[model samples]
Target chain A: MLWLTFILAGLATTLPRASFIVLGGRVRLPPTLQRALRYAPAAALAAIVVPDVLVVAGDFAPLNPNLAGVSAAVAAALLSRNPWLPFIAGMVALHALRWLPGG
Target chain B: MPSASFRAGAREGFLAFLPLSVGLVPWAMVTGMAMVGAGFTPVQAMGMNFIVFAGTAQLGTLPLIVAGVPLWLIVVTALALNLRFVIFSAAIAPGFRGAALPMRWFAGHLLTDGVFACCLEKMLAVDDSRWRLGYYLAPSIWSWALWQVFTLIGVFAAGVIPKHWSLEFMATIALLMLLVPLARQRPMLVAAAAAGATAVVLRGMPLRLGLIVAIAVGIGAGFAAEHWQDKEEAP
Candidate 1:
């Protein structure tokens, strides 16, 4: 049953994943579809990362470093001329103060 | 397949996963604790390390399995949790156009967030073929191998790792590390910020459904920001 689960999981994951790559060259997606696809990497990432970052201890607590992380992310977002440097600087700032009160 | 390239890619992927262990070990250790709570033996939890590479799905499934949910539900949810991989594979496809099938499959399996971001950076930065692939493979393999091996150690020593050591905290840190080197634009920044905020605001939703809602909102925010910027760029 566990092996079967793995198989099911693998198929579910691999099919959708490989589908676009395998067929992208042959397919002629509309411009709207293409535009949506362009936003995918970031959108999917936001969907996954946001909830994890913000929630603390339980649902209704103070915002905490999760917001700080986002704020830091915004700072990095603004300082986009050299992407990696700002990204690292903001993250360092968060971790340094992550343990502080009222973050 | 060329022996050198095969070894090089696999080696790189494995090493890239190394530092992830420092973060994943605690999470997997918790998974170990969950497995025991759910009546799974430590070995079963350890075995799961090889079988399922996703952190969120592994943590999520523990409860469902414990509750005697159908196997189909657990597997389906895991797949859903990893739905972003579809976007990743799509974006990365163009880079592997002429690569061998086995090579491509290996790359796909190893495409975690860090590895993917690093590889994409390498791909976009370099015009040459040899070093571009090699540089990408270097950190990726390291990270992967570290994750799998430490995952096992976490299972074995689940009891020993300090409770307050903050494994999940470190994972977020590691995640932040990977993103730093990659966020080069307004849309990406807006998307991340909005997504994270949305996730927080929606935290009350059941079964982590709030997460799904937040992600959608964040993605929309990102897309809209990008479109607005494009309009501003028009002469």
Candidate 2:
């Protein structure tokens, strides 16, 4: 079942990537759809990340360590152009928050 | 033999992508680590790396797989995360028009965000199809190789790493990293904020349906924001 899931997931991504390329000039996506697609990555990523960081064990926790870590990540992202900085900052922040005296 | 322009384009493409390749290392490793940390066997983790070849989708769907959600839902989630590729394909499809079917399929399969941006920029400057193809494939192949190698390292390393480090959170951070940049634009910002808030509020929903709902709400909010921005900008 797990293997099947991976295969299907692969197909899901591949089909879209291949959609226009293989179909050639015969078809075209509507312009409105193209504009909406720009936000798909941001929206989907936020939907995935928010629940993971903001919710702890299936409940919303506004003061969680993960929030602090993500905040640090956002700060790093804005301050530095290097993509690695945010991840490093985020992981360090998460660890620091987790290991803090009472936290 | 390929033409000189193709060779030059390939060299340019590789050099152009070299700097960006460094950033993918940590992201790929975290993805590999997250896969193993999520309880997937090393084999399964590597399989996903090769098969999906998409870091965000792999990370996005890990929790779902761990939660034992329905297969369709996992695929749908992955698809939603990958919808950006459709736009990418559409943008680049013109460059590959009239190319062989297999080559087109192969090129599309290898398409990625970094390669798309780099290749698209080069494609616009040159009219030669061969040069464009070379530019597209050079970074596409290099990035694929780099991603696989790093991800494999992470998969095996996860076996020895302590579980308490919570490495899976790295995946979330990686996703956050991807999200933050896109959020710089107003519409994208609105979309991310709306989606994130919605997902948090709906986190308790069964079958992880909240993710799908949040994505829809986010897209709607982003579209509306874009429309409003256009209206305001118009004289």
Residues B1-235 of candidate 2 have per-residue lDDT tens digits of 9889778888999988775566577778889888988998888999999899998789879999999988888998898778767767876677785578999989989988767745664664678888878888888999999999999999888778887877767777766765665687899999999999998998877656787788778988999999999999999
Best by DockQ: 2
- What stretches of model 1 exceed 4 Å from their correct place? A22-24, A27-42, A56-58, A63-103, B1-39, B124-138, B162-166, B180-184, B201-213, B230-235
Candidates 1 onward: DockQ, in order: 0.29, 0.59
iRMS for model 1? 4.6
Residue pairs that clash (backbone atoms under 3 angstroms), model 2 = none
**Relative to the unseen true structure, what is the C-alpha lDDT of residue B178 in candidate 2, on a scale of 0 to 100?**
57
lDDT of candidate 1 over B120-139, digit per residue (tens) = 54454445445445555566
**Root-mean-square deviation per candidate:** 5.6, 3.7
Give the C-alpha miss distance for residue A47 in model 2, angstroms. Answer: 2.7
Which portions of model 2 miss their true places by more than 4 Å? A1-9, B1-20, B34-44, B56-95, B113-128, B202-213
lDDT of 2 at B100: 85
